[model samples]
Target: MNSNRPGVLILSHCGFSFLEDLKEQLQRRQLRCFVLTSLPLAEHVPARLEQIQVWADRLYTADSHQLKLEDVNNALQTLHKSGEQVTCCISVWEGYRHLMAAANAALGTYDIDAQQALALRNKLNVRNQLADAGLSQARAHALTAPVLQTLQAQSARYFIKPIHGIASYAAFPLREDTTWKALETLRLASVEDTVYASAFNDGLQFMAEDYIAGQEFSFETLLIDGQAHVVAIHEKYEVTETADTVLEDSCTTPPASLDQAQIAAGLQWLEKVLTCMALRWGCYHIEARFTGQHWDLIEINPRVGGSLISHSVEAVTHGHSMLSLWLDLLLASQDDHAPRDALAQQLNAFQWQADGISAQSVATFFRVYFAQPGTLSSVALNELPLAPTVKHILLKAGDVIPAHAREVFLGQLLWAFDRSRQAEELERLAHLSATALDIRYEPGTP
Candidate 1:
């Protein structure tokens, strides 16, 4: 560890609570930490910053980054001019990576700059590069139909997804009709199409490409020395939050569900992507679907998987912590890790419990996050409200909350046991959580 430098900077948007576990973990290792809370409201700003600063060595407000470009630059310039050096600037939050990159560039710190960072966040740009560079991938098109005339020129089942999205946010199966609707509604033909749909379309930018339908699993990796070394193959169990109406009823994952061949194929596929992306000095959470014999590319996230996948990895492996390694790399002048294969040394069975939510009004959900459970006696308040069927609820009353679900993965109940017992255990637990929450969705959206 570089005792000369403090530690890394954890940049967050809206709320900084997400960095809590990482800060605590680092302090356990006897390291200093800094926190900057970005709040949406002005009046509440300094108080929140000070509250964290009491525990943290320093603080920063998000206006320090978002309001003005120089706000971020000046901070960096001031830090450097004051004779300070950063080990690595990190953002487990995907959206804030741009701010991290921007700050690092301003400080001339050791990190990936604003341009190279784009390859990770911008999908269309990545798609074009993959196609032109001949990397292993399922093809992608940003056009709607008459516009896809050029895409139809290339034959494949083609998957469609937004250029900027996270947590499998809005990715889904698409056909010719989807392409036509999107292009026609946006008048895609009238304008020259670009890699990012955000500029030209009112809705979201989507890519239509060959849908690689097969056994699907997640791949977690950290690149070192321009190589995409493979990590654990996560057994992903999820429900489509889009098509489903009964929000809390969806979501289920069994145990040890991936085949050896599927694992091998996913590893092979990411190698090509890492190389093409020239990814080095960071972590990536990639989703790939394997057909009968071929591995097709889904989307790649150059960050850790949310829902505490990193925590689960450490629980199972009992080895290197993903966040620690990520921070080490970000702070490293030398690019190195225990080696991808060695890093994920544990295969012990574990599953993430990212089930479902009530999908009600933000205000309604607010009760679940902030109000405390009233001892089943005092006044009255549904402590675990929000359609109680959601089990193993993490939010306690009086606990401050983040604005969006993306920052926190709300799981009903997660059962961890032997793989043999996991299925039955999860079933019983899921049933219990379902009954407890009893989430009821009335006919229409309120």
Candidate 2:
């Protein structure tokens, strides 16, 4: 491999399903792709390891599941010494953002700094930043005995969540009877006994924030030079709150509940929030709530939204997934001003339409199915007169669904329909949720 050739470094903790598409796109631009993953190859499934081997020009694996900063720095140093000049670094995994940022800093690439990445990962820090700027109506307190006592005294409803969390783990409504001991027990069980333990980079800390009531939506946005460009807006039509976590099962894009005017207003408010937080560049999956009067912050994810969000966005944008666009943005950031400006213009003028369909007439919806903790026997979707456009199965027969797993997804389905059929389609989705998906555990198993 020529050291002079441009290269992109990807840091991953566990995800690899997107490698094929990402590799094809990168190869088109004549760039070499390198991957550094915390997941040891010996423990990885053969199918996924094959995906990585097919994608990376070079693959480096850490000794453990959790990556250390020193190990990441050493890998970059080795690449540089070998004449592989990595110009950009990226990761879709939230747990590795700081590592990505650090790598970019060392390589003189474009990305937020390590400090900013750390700040963004902490829910408490984000809440305080929004509160200081008056962008949030909710007040958050660290989960301590004193803070719990204070919340009790206020006699107001609040939500408890991990300060550094993924997949809505350890998130629940804070009740009057909720105690510090109960929270600790849940945190230990959820964090220590699960596969995502490494994601909680910031130790076992939690927070309780004032709960805001309204319709929940997420803005899939891109920022260039401090300006926000919304690529898609998804309305969470169905959210289930469990005893320990929150599961968002279904979503529809172009927000079936909000009109064009309201969507425009949301975009404006989102720009302000991003500006206040000083989040200047990259893809952002920002979750927020809309009261009848105004919008409040839920949380801001500095990566592509998970599940089928990237796929749905790609469908609406006529072939641009959040990951693809983010890659383009990173490559463009290293180029001269002319190319960067051109990309900025294109992102700003994007519309949600595909195959010549008008933006208002096209809607993409997806539903996720989850399984309980047990030895899985089988999983399948009953034959439907009309099937979804895409189907993804995450588990197979004989796989054990861990009791402490944050969100054990069985499969996911996505469909595209005309906006006029939104009502009818949603009803069908509800029916599928109740009966279409069949997940069975082993006999006599809970």
Candidate 3:
């Protein structure tokens, strides 16, 4: 019942590894947090529950995957009746962006509309939206049997994936010369993969887009009052996709490899897309490719980048985390009539933090993937750096790993190293991963 403390409603804490860090940040700001999740409270670890009980004002569970708009409004009304106020509604997960928008709109808070949120999430919809804006995008077609036949007849090369996909799930390149048998195999695999893929898409509808060729990069940004501010640009290092999925092997923030002009061009492209999409308030994780001529739109999500990227951002920016900046923007939106210029100034302030770390240090997130399929008996890594670094082992001994599926990774190693030795350190890190790391499999487990 503390009226002075602003309240935030977060949806579905499931499958998010960094919820504790997020909760700690909110706690430090003295904000009252309420989590509405589909997971039962009993399923959580007692230690986790203790921490949640300490910080979260309430954790409500429902039967649905994402709480419906009416459900969220009812909860907000009940909280108001109890002398609590929910100032904002948002979710850090990619799957619930639109659902969060619906709740925010219902609460008369700052948010993107449901329609726009959908466009941001659905890749095909985004391509269409950018095309309408005269923005260049890969030519795409829906992946139907007839459409595949038609494309085959025309002999075109395209990238095929589900309408709503995540982490490169069900994403593959379709060759014009690909046989019908190969297409059928891909379709069957996609249907199976979609069953366990992230939030949206049932693996039914897919699209084939003209493959945009170039080196890929991720631009982390924030849109406030219709202005897009670039936080950091990451150079995504991906291994060749001998398999169906192409996942990021690692990524370096501030992309030391890219020159100033290239960085500006990437940010400019982001602003163009944001302008066309009319994003008013939120964080954006945009992936694109630079063809040495122009930047081609890959996909844009209206949420913070996943996989603990915020930790690396904090390391690079001293202490400013993208989540904190985003939360600050939401808090600023509490003003019923804040001028756009004032909001623009706030954007500038955030940009200063992001730009301040450009010259001091560089951060990298290295993902470890096992090429062989079997039950992992044990894994060992070489001596890790004594400096600030975070390591996560996703799989343990005796866990079965599927063949050629990039979704399941052995672990991730993140570190913030000296800027001057970035190239040397990266090469050393790669050598250590290949030579210093050892993996053993259970006998006859594959």
CA lDDT scores, all candidates in order: 0.49, 0.79, 0.68
Choose 1 or 3, whichever is better by lDDT: 3
TM-score of each: 0.68, 0.92, 0.85
The superposed Cα distance between candidate 1 and the true structure at residue 12, in angstroms, equals: 1.3
Model 2 has an lDDT value of: 0.79
Which pairs of residues have clashing backbones in candidate 2? Answer: none
lDDT of 1: 0.49
Give, for candidate 1, the lowest lDDT window spanning 10 residues: 358-367
lDDT of 2 by residue, 339-391 (tens): 67888778755643222122444678899888888898988888876688778
Model 3 misplaced regions, further than 4 Å: 1-4, 13-17, 40-55, 64-66, 153-155, 176-198, 336-365, 368-374, 385-388, 400-406, 434-439
Clashing residue pairs in candidate 3, if any?
none
Better of 2 and 3 by TM-score: 2
Q: lDDT tens digits, residues 1-446, model 1? A: 22455555566554453577668765875665655445534544667566676766555665432323444555555555655555546677666666677766654454555667655767777767776766644666665555466655555665555576554433555544445554343344323222122222344555666666665556666665565544345544433333201012322222134455545545665677777777664677776666667665566776776554555444333444567656645554333444333433321122121121111111101011111212111112234322332224444333333222122333333333344455554545444443443232223312
lDDT of 3 by residue, 1-446 (tens): 45667778877644243566667777878888887764433434455556566667876655543456566666777777778778787788667678788887877767788778877777887787787777875667777778887876775567877688776765777765655566566556654442244354454467888888888887777777776777667777655564567767777766756676776776777778778877767788888988887888988878877765676666666776778766766666655556445656655643523222335355564544544677888886666454327776667777776653336667776767776777877777665554445678899865
Error of 3 at 140 (Å): 0.8
Best by lDDT: 2
